[model samples]
Target chain A: MNHLFFQINPLEGFFFGSGKAMVVAGVAIIILIGLGLWLFRMESRLQRLNDALDQRLNDAQNQPS
Target chain B: MIQRSWKIGGLALLGYVLCMIFFVPLGPGLLEFTSTGSAGHVQDQDRKVTVYALTGFGTHWTESPDQLTVVLRHGTQLASLPLIETLDATHVLVGMDLPYTVPSKSWDVLVTHPVDGTLLLENGVFLQDRFIDEQTKWANPEIAEYPAELPFHFPYQPQILETIRNLMLHVPMWFTMFLLMGISFVASIRQLSTAHDLHQDTKAEASVQIGLLFGALGLVTGSLWARYTWGAWWVDDPQLNGALVTVLVYAGYLVLRATIQNIRLRARLSSVYNLFAFVILIILLMVLPRFSESLHPGKGGNPGFNSYDLDSSLRAVFYPAVLGWMMLGTWMYHVRLKASSIERKLRQLQ
Candidate 1:
């Protein structure tokens, strides 16, 4: 267990060897992913809201008023 | 026209900051030193010791070998060592004659060059005392005067090294988060004043959402920085814990908003809760950290990067990065607010 804990995987080794510049890359990637997820959630919410609005409009048109 | 300019300006400024962060080179710094015969430790009996040094970027040691000089400093006393050889641009050998009795056991190394300025390695060499003599006289050499005009470069910190570039990224995230949270706080106040205006409530909610996102990014970047610098991903630090708690508290505000069924009651309750959360944010992030012991810089009586670490070169990019990030975060909050308004309109139609 101790040996395993001390052993650095290839990915970790690459980051460590590169003067931890990859850590900065990792941070930038995380921010990009976060922003992307937020945008996607907004898109889906808008889609759902548009569908609801369309359904209401169709129901109003069908009714004899 | 004015509104469009800010967005364009923000993008431009961030692009400039990104370019500068990557392109700017670090100043000269001493990495490590070694003695040819005895390993860095000198005894009073030893007459001469030749010390070899390895330096990080911008040294240019071989260019003007005549101007380069090495000195050992113990408190106020200084002794200039002879530069024996300049091996390369980044390596040099200096010879030091051991004094019979010195003022101190620990000695600081200062390598000075006109072009590179002065690079210091604190407690670089240690002396093993054969006898402690109180009346021994020490030579005091004058410190080198740096030229008025020096090349523009980031300050090379021994520990931080290249990862210092993260300053532009990590620090700006918190600044952006703070600006968004401030917007949320103001909107919440307006929400309470204006007789359950759902628009104001939506504004508060949207800003909090964006603020939380920026706060999470700050935590992640800070954790990575801490992992490299402090040798731990997470430490029991006051400033760090305070920031984490502030993020969690804002998260609690979102959870509270979801639980309430009636729209009017929800707005009222959440607005009041937002006020409390904002207060908690200020206390946890700004006030408490200052009073307690913390590993994070600028907290717990620790002199912040502003005092010595943040040189003029760093400030050139850092201020613009903060402003750019805040503008981007505000733009995101506006987008979130617009979507929320459209959603509200659709729900009202139903």
Candidate 2:
């Protein structure tokens, strides 16, 4: 059609209409990234807990039972 | 042994989901098309109407213009129009020689391709004339049937289109969330019966934490999907509101656990709250939505995964996606449970 320009209107080009697939993919990626951060935090917490447990065990042994 | 089984099962199902989701090609079908003039309207005089076609695949119409024919069909009646000339991979221009007036009603397009073997696009073309009901006399009562042995793929719904692919990601998140919350509910019941056992409390907490993660993912994905399809990020639909409320209730459960000073009291109180929240979660997500009107399909007397929306082709990948996500959530819960147990042992050493 004569009047049909490229339908890119602002950010709608990236998120709306046929661009919906990209939006969904972005959401999936964000979820994975969030989970990755959660895992990293959990690992750090576990490491600290393990270190505390080891220190307590060592302290009890040094105190002669 | 149980931990090893969990790891193996979770990994296997996740792999299955990844393989099936990416490897399966989208089915070939007409997505949409619009002419320079309004759809379904016949011009009073002769004019050049440029047809723009949006097909899933370009291979169907890559052939020379002579090989493909665009025909208008109404009931048993059929009229073949001339292709005005320009032919691209997915578009065509048809010069209409309207000898007689075609009344206003929805018309179908039959694209006869040498390779595609008479591919049909229902409601493909519309011819709107002033005389509305007069066109029914020329209507074709015969329905066009698709080839039975087509490859496995999701159906192309008008509003959803390519976003139908999100069905695998978004819907499965909610399903998995519900599953994890269900596990948490069971664990809470066990904790109460066992007089707030530490292990059961840890398991319940882990399940709820992972379940909340999945629930949050579902909400974000659903919101984005609604933005494109329903023209808004959030709507006042019962199913959506119910999900938001359920997640908030679970958040309160976490807050309650954190505030209580005594371990046993925290376990007992949180377990009771979790039981209440799970009941509300079920009522909000499942029961209440069904009883009220909602835009979400399969809810409020809407036809859901019936013979229509979720066709056999979709069910192939959908079932595995649901299973894979549920298993993955369980794996996350197991990891959290392991961490909690390690913390408890550390406390004992202290």
Best by lDDT: 1
Model 1 C-alpha RMSD to native: 6.0
Residue lDDT tens for model 1, B1-350: 79667766776677677667756766677776666664332334354564655443546777778888788887787888776667777777766565666777778988888777788899988776435565666767777657424567788776676678889989999889889989999988998898846899999999999999999999999999888778899999878888899999999999999999998888889999999998998888878877877777775553235556677889999999999888878878887887887778777766
The TM-score of candidate 1 is: 0.82
lDDT of 2 by residue, B1-350 (tens): 77456555655565555555544555445545455553322235355443444342323566555766666776667766666544455556665443356654677777666545465678886665324554444533333443523456555455665467678879889989888988989988899999835889889999999999999999998998898679899999988999899999999999999999899998889999999998998788878877887788786554234446777778877887788778778767876887887877777675
* Residues A1-65 of candidate 1: C-alpha lDDT, one tens digit per residue: 11121242343335435556445645654665466457556656776776777788778778966
Error of 2 at B244 (Å): 0.9
> Using Cα atoms with residue i matched to residue i, what is each candidate's TM-score against the true structure?
0.82, 0.73
After the best TM-score superposition of candidate 2, give how far the Cα of residue B309 lies from its true spot, in angstroms: 1.8
Give the CAPRI class of candidate 1: incorrect
Task: For candidate 2, give the lDDT of residue B279.
Answer: 91
Looking at chain B only, the TM-scores across the models are: 0.92, 0.80
